[model samples]
Every structure is written in structure tokens, then in C-alpha cells.
Target: LSFSLPKCDTMERFAGRVTVYSVVGCPHCNSAKAFLKGLGLPYCEVDVEKDSTVRQKVKELTGRSTVPQIFFNKTHIGGNDDLQNLVSNNGFFSPQIKKKKKNKPSDLMIPSIPCFTDVKGERDNFAELILEFKSSGIIKSHGSFLKVHKLTFSGSELIEWLVDKKGFEKDQALNTGKELMQKKFFSDVSGKGDFQDGHTLYRLIEHDCLTALNSGKTAECSPVLAAELSEALRRLILKLYGEHLSPDGKTVDYKAMENSQTFQEYCELATQLQRLELKSMTREEKLAFFINVYNALVIHGHIKMGPPKNLWQRYKFFNGVSYLIGGEVFTLQDIENGVLRGNRKGVGQLTKPFSQGDQRLQVALPEAEPLIHFALNCGAKGCPAIRSYSAKTVDAQLKTAGEAFLEGDDGCHVNSCKNEIRLSQIFKWYKVDFGDTNEKLLQWVAEHMADSPKKKELKELLGKGNHKVVFLPYDWSSNSKD
Candidate 1:
């Protein structure tokens, strides 16, 4: 068979912790801080001015200079305005993926290439992003960094998936990709809006491999590295790509990945990654592990759900949604099944991503919504910001994920003036899941927000001491692509 969907697929782990950074005096910084505290969150704050050298160094690392500069796990969620957007939307409130975090990273090899004038230079180097992963007395690295993707799918496939399924058009996908790719190019700490995206980087990188496959062009970068990465990409495609034809749909024997080097390595690593039992893991490790499991499980859940949302990458599937996990078609339902419940697959079980927070590792769940919300991509607009960093340990990854989620619209706090203050339906739909009473829930919510009619509305509802939060509809639109 050229290609066919597997009968089943399984995903493990779900949810993760979060991390944040801010300056002392800045109002935005103060707001960000007060808001997180209102959410009953534990964060690490640094005064950029107190340590002059540190400020300079932060500027250098993330490639910018700004106060109240922040990072959500790996994704740079931008400043206060950006964070407000994350909370404003019905960010990642379901079995669906939240578009909490994602940014345009420049081609690391492309600093030599100059971009158009439209792209802004990054203001704050991502010192906060990196520091949150391993701040003293905060969380430490208790998890391992791991890359779960097969590097399959191309810009075209990604574009189609995002445009058709996730609600973006070709230009939207292309434009966003350009911004993110641009960030990776210069290793710019800031996003691509600062960096120029008007011009295409397609021509800059070596197009030999893609050219052969008729893959079109990429941007300028290290010719050698581009060529190497291109070859790698091609190999990744060949190795991971799958296809199947249906002539009246005669069932063909589906072939599973057979002893592939990378696949085996991934499987083995996953084996080790999924078995933490929460004891050995540091606080950080637990968070990362859960986030990884959550992310992978989300992908698995969508597949097992019987219908694909067509939001995330589709090149990895056989039919519109045809991949196997465990022995049956995998779906979000199946993925969710693994949560709180144990799955035979090394996933689901909390050997690595611990739900329980450990005081020793300087980490705690702290209602740990932001990290998991952001790190795990659910193909939505309100999720956390996704970062470029590949999580190794569950703790660090989850912390990063948490931060990204909060930084994005999905976080508990967001701009009322802009979001139109529709309390996330999550509160209403699963009001009981939030807290004892409306007051309790509002108290919890107050932890993340400053004040406004939105907060007042919530307070009014919560003050009534009712657990019935108004149902806010979830936006299923995938955050990726666009």
C-alpha cells in the first residue's frame, strides 16, 4: 500500500506547569506580576535595573532591550498587550489544542542576510525565557529535552492544513511562517514583526534538495547549513511521509514504521520519558513531562476522535486522519482517556510529567494551567504561545509551556478593553471544575487579572456564591498556520 491510516494510535501525558518573568517598576511589568499572583501562581521576578549587567546580558541573549520583557516557556509571548490577548480569547479550554504560543523564529543561520525594513529588531533578549527554565530557588531542570516530531510535512502541506482546517489563507500561512522563520534566522530574541517579513528568505538558503523535489525556494542563510538542513528535510519527508489509495477502498495491509533509526530512538526515549512516578522528578521535570504528554496526547486524541480537525500537521496522516496508535484509530478521546487513567503505552502514566508538584525542585503545579495550555499546541487562537525550544525534561518544558500559555491569550489574564470580556466558556461549561463557589473562582481569577468590568462581572457572578459560571463557547480554530 502506498499509504493507509493506521487502525489506532495512542498519545500520553497532558497538561503542564508555567513560568514567567518581569521587571519591578514597569507598570506593565507590575501588572503582569500582580495578575499572575491573583491567579495564585508562583513566578520568579527579576528587576532589570537592580542588576545592570544582567539587563545588558538579557538584551544580548534575546536580541532586544525592553522592560517587563517576558517569555512563556519557549514561545516569546511578547509584552503586556500580547499577554492580554492570550487571556482574552477562550484560550485552550478543551480537548482541543490552544494556540497559546507560537512565534516567528528567524533562521539561525541567516544573520548574514539582511531583511526588509518592515521587520522590527527584537527589543529584549530572551533572558527571561531561558532563566525561567533554571532560575535559582525557582524550578530547576528536572526533565529531559526531547523532540517528538518526525520533521515531516513541508511549507505547502503546512499551509494547506492551516488554511483549510485552521482558518488561515495561503498568504496568512506564508506570512506567519516568514515571521517565525525569520526569528530563527537571526536567532533574534524578539519576533519577526520587528524583523522584516516583506521579503522572502526562500532564495537565501540552499535550494538544491528542495529544488530537486520541486519544493520551491527558501530564504538566504548559510549555504552549507541550508543544504545540509534541506537534505535532512528531504530525508525526513521520505522517512515520515505516508500515502494510500482507495479504489472503492479495498483494505490494504497497513505497514507500520519498521525499525527506523529515528523512530526507534524516539520510542526508546519515550519509554524512559514516561516513567517518573513523580518521586524522582524535580518540580520542573514534572511540569515538562506533563506538557510533553499533553502535547503528544492532544495529537493522538484528535486522531482517535474518529474525525480529524485538520488543524495541526496533516502530512503525518494517511487519510484526512488515518494513523494508528496502540492497535486502533487514535483520537482526542483516547488521548484524554490516558489522562488520570493509565494507558498501557508508556504514555498517560506520570513517570515523568508529574501532576504533583515537588517542593524540592522549586516547582509546584500552582493550578498549572499556563504551561500546559501553551506548550501543548491545540490548533486554537487562545492557547499559550509556542516556543522553539524542544523540551527535554517535563519540568522545564512544562514550565516553559505554562509561561507561554499565560503569556498568550489562553492565560487567565488578558485585556478586557480588547477581548470584549466573554469569560471563557470553560468556567460556565465546567464551573464545578473551577472552585467551590463563584466567589472562590473569582478569587482565583483575580490572581491573574488587574481590574475592570470583566473582573467586576466575574466578581458579581462569583460573589453570588454560585458555582455556575457562564458558559463561554470555545473557539476550535487551530492557532497554528495563522
Candidate 2:
């Protein structure tokens, strides 16, 4: 069943009464979300890592700063397994969301533009535009593609108004427009023709479109744009991969890029590229830009050890297309590995103890334990759930991913009877976390299941007659990694 969270106005109803204290790096957060959804109970999710307010509140409430901390009608629902037990015994919520009210296509999706201006100009009317898509039933599944068309149009219209109403050369503006579209490192097919003078494209894509679309633009493009964007997006995902990136490999330090104060600088670079009159960049150029962003983000996500803000970079998903990387038209895997040249870290690493051996100026990726184990969707039955944000900054992405990890049941599956255990294959592959013993892992799982009837069942299952454990086989087949 599909369920969206409660919005701002109604959020207070979820506060101390039933708020969930979660950090971004835990997968259990997502599962908590899903669990709550299953029970039809609405909750307010505060990313403790991202939101200081929530962090402070959580520390005061739980005394600990971890994630997937849930508060029911008023009591603490605990973490993933805790919530799972709540679900098993029927205590998580009162009901599922009143069957989602029919949605309008025009209300499909609203691009949440990143507020990055020193002084805001006439912002493109993003709010009004959404009504159009929602009027259409695009409850807008998957990536908000419906909004992409509007983004393209909105960007183009803004650019046109800027050029015609503001007096800019048509040719230069059009080229500038192309550059802006290219800058997303994503495709801008529909808006291509509209920004011929470069100015139109520039005005809308940069000031109007990109800003308005913020992190939401990628999901709204057309099939062509979607294909191009996904391909472009996947290209760089390779960069974030680990040294030993095998289904069977242990966690590798796939350091994604670090956060910088030079975000505006990147925007300027896009403008410069536009002014260069670099005729429509070739497919290779487009692909290159996408890869550049994807790789940078992936590397950052891996090293940070958390969830990617954007869902795509969290997991390596290459739906149906394949691209030529390094030399061959490598699937996502080769491209990911291609990022690695000499050391375990990859080409540009300079940290001595780590990769290049230079640690002074280094800002290691935070922690990706969350996303790798949870957020990135791999089409696998149990792969992590991809989110709405972009994994542009690995640190932020990893934190969000981590939140989802600790919150989901995938990592620690409590049996139907609550007596036995079925943990993720990751626990087996990376057995060190559990003190090198199933008993230890079982002990840990028992903590979350502490007050539940499942605890009795689990203790009975493992300690009683059988004295046996069933290791749930992981789904190694999907994730569209290639």
C-alpha cells in the first residue's frame, strides 16, 4: 500500500505526541516509516543529523543519539525491530492512511528549488505550475517526470521573459540556455528548442528552472529526458563504488566528494560554459557531465558511510540501458571500478594513510553504512528503498541512507513467530559488527525485541528445543548495478 507522510500544518499533531526521533544514517527509519504507513499512522520524521532541532530533542528524550526512535500515541515505539514487534502485535497505529484521496495530475510534484541566492529575484511560479501536473493523476509515481516538463517549460518561459522583456541577444542567450540544461548534468530535451538564443535557456534553466527544480528536477523529465537523465546519472555512480566492489566484497572506502562552500562557483562554471558558445555538447559531453556528478556523489556517499540525499546515487541502478565506459560499453560496474586506478581508494585520492597519503586537507566521507545497506534500491526484493533527494553531497546522503538502514527490517528480520531469527546476508558477510557470533547478533536483536512477545518467541526459538537459527538467503540478483 502507498502512503505519504503528513505535511507541515498537520505536523504538530505528530509532535511529542507521536514523533519519531531518527538520524539519517539508519535504515530502520524508512522501515519505521513503512511500518507506520502499514498501520496507517502518520508520523513526523526529523533527520537528527540534518536538523539540529530534532537532534537536541532526541538527545533530551532518548539520552542516546541513534536513529529509528519512534514515539507512538505517546510512548516510545523503539527502533526497527521494536516497531516490527509493534506491528506484529498490532500496536503501531490505528489504521492505514485514509485510502489516498484521488490525486490530480497537475498536483503531481512540486520541484523544491534550493534557496541559493544572495538576493532572490522574481522566483518562477513553481507553486502554480504543480497544479497543472496534478490535474493530470500523475500521483506521479517513480521520478516526478511530470514536473520535468513543467520545469523545462517554466525554465524556458522565464528565459524568454528575461530575454524579450529584459533585452538580451537571442543567440547568446540560447547557447547559455543549453549550457544551463547541461549543467544539471542531466538532460533538458524539451526545453532545448525553447532556449535557442541561450538567454531563454539560461534564464529558466539556471535562475528559473534549476533553482526551482532544486533537487527535484531529475524525476520530472519525459521518457527521453528520463532515459537520458538516468543514463547521465548512472554514469558517475561508478565513481562512488568501493575498491573490492563485488557482491561478495566487504565494505570498501568508496569516498564520494566532500561538501564545499563553492556551490555558487559551480553555478558560475555553468554560466562560463554557456558563454563559450560550445555548440550543443555531444552525447559524450552530456554523458560526461552526468558521470562527473554521479561519480563525485558516489565516492562521497561510500566514504561518508550513509544514505545518499538523492536516491539514485545511493544504489547503482541502471534500469535497461548500458554505456561505453573506459573502453568498452561497460555496465555500471566497470565504470564504478574504472574510477579506481592504483590504490584501494582510486585515482585522485591524496590521503597517505588512506589513498594518496595526504590527510591534512582531507575530509573523509562521513559514513555510508546506512545507504549501502539500506537506501540504494537494487531491484532486489530486499534492496534498500530509494528516496527523493539527490546524493550530490555524500555526507548528507550517507546520513540519510544510514537512517533508512537502521529503520528497515532487511538488516534484522524478526521471525513471524517472533521466536526465530532471519538476519540480512550483510550480517553474515560483514560478521565483525555482531562480535563474530550469531549468538551475539541474536543478543543484539533481542534488545530491540526486549519488551515484545517476539522476544519470548525468539528466546524460545533460539534457546528452547531447536537451538537452531535460519539464515535468510540474501537476494543477490537485482539492484540494476550495471
> TM-score winner among the candidates?
2
Per-residue CA lDDT of candidate 2, range 249-338, in tens?
223322212233233223222222211211233333322333343333333333333433343642333311223211112222322222
Instruction: Write candidate 1's Cα lDDT for 1-482 as tens digits.
Output: 11111111110121222233343223355566555555443444444433344544454445444445555333455555555555635433222113422322221210121211111112323223222222222211222267321112234543454466557777886665555344332121211133233321121111112211111222222122111222222222222211211111111111233234533333232222111124344434344434434344333323233223453443233122211211122233222222222221222223422223312122223332432333444434443332222223344434433333322333444333333323554454334434667555556555544334445655554445434333345665532111
CA RMSD, predictions in order = 25.8, 18.1
TM-score of each: 0.31, 0.32
The weakest ten consecutive residues by lDDT in model 1 span 3-12
TM-score of 1: 0.31
* lDDT of model 1, residue 405: 33
Off by over 4 Å in 2: 1-16, 21-68, 72-74, 80-84, 87-330, 340-375, 384-393, 396-472, 476-482
The count of residue-pair clashes in candidate 1 stands at 120
After best superposition, candidate 2 residue 78: deviation in angstroms?
2.1
